[model samples]
Target: MTKSQKWVSFLILSMTCGVIYQVAYIRFVFLGPTARALDVSSQDYANIISVFGIVAMVMYFFGGWFADRLSPKFLVVTALAVTGIADLYLGTVPGYWGILAAHVVMAVAGMGLYWSALVKAIGMLGDSSEQGRLFGFLEGVRGVTSTVVGFVGTAVVAASVAEAAGVLWLIRLYGILCFVYAALVWLFVKGDDRRLAGLGSSTVTLRQLWRAARNRYTWLIGGTVMLMYCFYTTLGYFSPLLEHRYGMAAALVGVIGVVRTYVFQFVAGPAGGVVVDKVTRSTPRFLRWMFAGCALIALSFLVLPRDSAFKWVALALMFALCLLVFASRGVYWAQVGEAGIHPDERGGVIGLASGIAYLPDAFLPTLSAWWIGDPSATPAVPEQGGGYTALFLFLLAVALLGLGLTTLTDRTRRRELAARAAPAGAEAAPLAA
Candidate 1:
C-alpha cells in the first residue's frame, strides 16, 4: 500500500479502537455505571457527558491550532497514550468523580487526536477536489468500526453473564485493548514524516484565522454542522428515549443504537458524498438539495407529537432524520472547499467550521434532560430524564435556522458555476468566490 494509505489505515484503526474504548464504557459512566453496578440517574449521566463535551471543545480549538504549529504525530500518539491511562483508571476507579475526571482526560486525548495532524494528514493523501469523498470514506469506516466493536464486545459481555468476574474482566479488557491500540498507532507512525515536515515559516496568522471564522459562509456552514450533530447526538440517547416511552429492554435499545450506526443513518454519510459529486457541476446550487433535506427533517420533528402514544413514531422520526442529517453534514464540509477557500487553509477552515459547529455537544443533553425531566412525570425517575417537548422544539428551531443559513449561501453564490469558469486572476470574479 501507499504511505498515505498506510498512515490513514493506522489512524482509522486508532480512532476506531480509541473510540471503542469510550463507547463500550459509556454504559458504565455516570449514567449507566454497570461495572460499579450502580444505576445512576440519566441527568447525572448527561452532566458527565456535558463536562466531556465542554473539555472536548477546548481540545478541538487547541488541537487544531497545535496541528498548525506542532507535530500532530506526537500530539496524537501522546494523546492516545494519555487516553489509555485514563481508560485504565476509568474502569478501575470506584468513585463517581474519578470516573468523570477520567472522561475529561479521554475527551481531550480523543479530540486532540482528531485535529492533531490526522485531519490534515488525510487531506494531503487525496487531491483537494476529492475532499468530500475522502471525508465520507473516513466517516463511513468509523461508523463501521464502532459498530463492529460494540457488537463483538456485547457478545462477549452478554455471554459472560453467569460469572461476575467475566463482566469486570470485559471492562478491564477494554483498557488493555487501549494499550494495544496505542501500540498500533505508534508502530505504524514510528517513522512517519506527515507532520510539521514542511511548510517552514509559512502559515496563516491568528488574525487570518479570526477572519475565516467571521466569514458569512463560515457561520452558515458551521450552523449546518451544529444542526447535523444535534441529530447525531440524539442517536445514543434515542434508545433510552425508546425505553422510557415504550418500556424496552437493554437488548432492544442496544439493537437500536447499532442499527442507527450501521444500517439506519451512517450509510447516508458516504452516499451524500456521491450525491455531491454528481451535483457539483451545478456548484453551490447543490446546497438547495441540502436545504430541502433540512426542511423535511424539521417538518417531521414538528409533526412528531409530544405524547407517548406516538413513541413508535419517534423511532421512525430519528431513523429517517439521521439519514438526512448525516447526508447534510457530509456535503456541508465539502461545500467549504467547493466555495473556494484556499487549500492551504483547508485544515483551519475545517477546524473553524468543526470547532464552532460542534458547540451544541457542550450542552444539548442537559437541555434535553431538563425537558421531560419532571420528578412527578413517571415512576422511572432516573429514566424519565426530562422534557421531550422543549428538546424537540429546540431541535426544530435549529433545523429551521439551518434552512435559513443555507438560503443565504444559495443567494450569495447564485452564479457559482458561471464563476467557476472564470480563469485565474480574472477581474470579474464571482462575489461569493
Candidate 2:
C-alpha cells in the first residue's frame, strides 16, 4: 500500500478500536439509565467499573510485550472478536458477577491484546517528526467515531419502553459493530507485522524490558499519564454532578456527557497535534502548558459557587476543562518519540508506561464514589459541594504533579541530547586538527 493508503487505513483502525474498546464502560458512566439497568448502588457500580481497570492494568505489560513479538494485525483481530463475543453475552444483562466476568474478558481483549498493538501500529505509520500529527489525527478520528456511536446508543435507549432493554440493545449494537470492524481490520490493516519487524526485534528480551523500565524518562512520562488519566476518569462524575447538583434531567445529562466525551477530542486532539508540531515544537514544553491549563481549570471548579447564576459559567468552564484535558491526551504520547527511546523497544516501553500510568484505574472510581457521595441519596446535601471541592482539589494537585514530572523529563532529555552532540563535536574537531 502507498503511504496515503496506509495512513488512512491506520486512522480507521485507530478510530474503530477507540469506539469498540470503551463501549461497555460508557453506559456505566452515563449515570441514571446505567444505574437503573445495573440495579446497583453507585458504590457497587464503581466497584464493577474498577474491576476492568484492575484487570487491564495487569494485562497491559504482557500485552505490550506480546505486541513487540506478534503481528499487530493478528492481535487486533483476535481482540476485537473476543470483545465482540463478550459484548454479546453482556447484552443478556447478567447478574453482577456475570457483569464482572464480562469486564475481565474485555480487559483481556481490549487492553491486553488491542491497546498496545494499536498504539504501536499508529506510531509506525509515520516518522518521529510526524508523531504529533499522526497521534493527533488518530485521536481526533476516534473522538468522532465515539461521538457518533454514543449518539446512536443514546437514541436507542431513549426510544425503548424499558431502559434496561434499551441498554441491552445498545450493547448488541456495539457487539455487531466490533465484529464488523474486526473484519475490516483483517482486510485493510495490512503488513503491520512485516513493517514493524523491520523496525524492532521479532522477540522481546528481558534486558530490553529492563532498559525501558530503568529509564527515568519512561517513569516520568508514566507519571504524567497516570495523573492526567486520573483527572480524565473523574470527569465521568460530571454527569452525575450535573444531574444531582444542578437538577439536570438524566437523559439530557447523558447527551451532554456523550458530547463532552468527544467534542473536545474532535476539536482539540488534532489542534493540539498541530500546535505541538508547529508552535511548541517540543512535546515536553507542550505538555507543560497543557498541565498548567489543567491546573487552572481544576482551580476554577474549586472557586465556582453552586448557585443558579453560576450554573452556565460552571458548565462552560467544565467544557473548556475537558477540551484542554483531552487535548493534552492527544499529544502526550508523542513524548514516546521525543524521549529518544529505541523504536525496537517501544512496545515494551509503551507497555511499561501504560501499566504504571493506569494504576489509578484501580482506585479512582471508588474514590470518586466516596467523594461524590451516593447518586441515590435523596435530598441534596451540603456534603455534595464539599465532596466536589475535595475532588477538584485532588485533581488540581494531580495536574501540578504532572507539570513537575514533565519538566524533569524535558531537562533530562536536553542533557542527553547535549551529551550526544558534544561527543560528535569533539570527534569532528579531532578530524579538523
Candidate 3:
C-alpha cells in the first residue's frame, strides 16, 4: 500500500472502531439521563448493560470465527450498518424492552462482528514488527475520535432545551456517523490478500481454534484483559461519584468524564505503544508494571477521603489511573506477537481471549449496581460508606489480580523465547568455540 493509502485505511479503521461504542460510552456520561429516559431505576439500567454484556460475550467468540473466515470489509460494513440502525433506534428513547433489544443488536454488531474484524484488519495494515505501534496508533486515533464525540455530544446536550432531547440527539448523531463510516469502509478499505481472510479449511480452522482455546497463555492474557476491563468500566461510576460526593453539577461531571475517559486516551495510547516498542520492548512486561501502578492507584482510591476536601486529589488519582489503563489497552494485543502464535491463528486466539476477557460485561455492571447503589440517591457519608467502599475494594482486587497475571504472562513469554533460542544458541556455541 502507498503511504497515503495506509494512512487513509488506518484513519478509517480507527475512527470506525472508536465511534461504534457510543451507545455504551454515552451512558457513562449521561447515566441518570438514560435511566430516567427508560423510566427505570439505575440498577435496572445497569441490568440492561449486563444483558448487553452477556450477549456480547457470546458474540465475541462468534465474531472471532467470522473474522477468520469472512472478508473483513464485509464484516465491518455490516457491523457499522447494524450499529447505525441500533443507535437510531435507541435515540427514539424506546422503553426498557426496546432499549434492551437495541443493546442486543449493538452486541451482535459492535462486540461480535465489528471488534474482532476491526482488530484483525488492523493487524494486516502493518508488518509483524510494527504491531505495537500499529495497535497503539489504533488506540490513539480511537481516543481522538471518541474524544470528538464526547465534546460534541456534551455540547449538544448542554445546548438542548431538555436533557432527554439532547441525549436523543447525541445518540442519533452517532448513528449517522456509523452509516457514513460504513460507506467509507466500503470505498476505501481494499487489497484483501487471502491471508488477510485467515484462509484455512473449516477443519483446519476448527483445529487451530481448539488449539488456541487450550493454550494457557490465552486464558492468562484473557484474565488480565478481564481485570483491566474491570478498571475501565468502573471508571464510569466516577461520574456519579463526583456528582454526589463533590456536589458537582451534572454538566461539569460530564466534562470531567470526557477528560478522564477519552482525552487521556489520546496521549496514553500512542505513548504506551511507543514505550512498549522502544523502552520495555515487551508488551506483557510493560503491562505487568502498569498493572502495578493500577494496584497502587486503586489502593489510593480505597484509602483516600471521599469527602469534599479531597475531591481534587481523587480526580487526580482517577486521571492517573486512566493513563495507566488506556496506555495498557493500546498495547495489550501486542501480546499476540510475543506469545509466538502463528498469524493464521490470530482470529481464534483473539476471539477466545475476548470471549473470556469481556465476561465482566455480563457481571460487573450488575454487581456494581448492587455495590455502589444509586450514587445520586446515596451520598458517601462516613456513617453510610459501604457502597463506594465496596466498589473501590473490588477495583483494588482486580488490579492486584491483573498485576499477578501479567507478571506470569511476561515470564512465560520470556521462558518460551529462551527455550526456542536454546538449540540455536547451542549450535552457535560449538562453531564459535
Number of the top TM-score candidate: 3
Q: What local lDDT score does residue 87 receive in model 2, on the 0 to 100 scale?
A: 89
Which residue pairs overlap in candidate 3's backbone? none
The regions of model 3 sitting more than 4 angstroms off are 1-10, 64-71, 119-136, 186-205, 342-347, 378-385, 414-433
Off by over 4 Å in 2: 1-15, 27-29, 64-71, 117-137, 161-164, 183-204, 342-348, 379-386, 415-433
Candidate 2 C-alpha error for residue 301, in Å: 1.3
Question: Of models 2 and 3, which has the larger lDDT?
Answer: 3
Pairs that collide in candidate 1 are 28-33, 371-386, 371-387, 372-386, 372-387, 373-385, 373-386, 373-387
Q: Per lDDT, what order, best first? A: 3, 2, 1
Clashes of 1: 8
Model 1: CA > 4 A from native: 1-21, 24-40, 68-72, 120-136, 156-171, 190-204, 262-266, 279-313, 344-348, 374-386, 415-433
Collision count for each candidate, in order: 8, 0, 0
Span of ten consecutive residues with least summed lDDT in model 3: 424-433
Report residue 160 deviation for candidate 1 (angstroms): 5.9
Comparing 1 with 3 on TM-score, the higher-scoring candidate is 3
* lDDT (Cα, tens digit) per residue for candidate 2, span 1-433: 6887787677678767566775556743465456567666777777877888899888866776778777777888888899999988877777789878988999988878887778777766766687767775776678778888888888888788986678778878889889899998887776544556555533345776688788776788888889888878888888766776666666777678777887776887778888999998888888888889889988987887766567677778878888877778878888998888887777667767877788888888878887777754654555553588889999999989988887887777777777777867733222200
Candidate 3, residues 110-190, lDDT tens digits: the string is 867888788778877776687768876787788888888888888988898887678888889999999999999999986
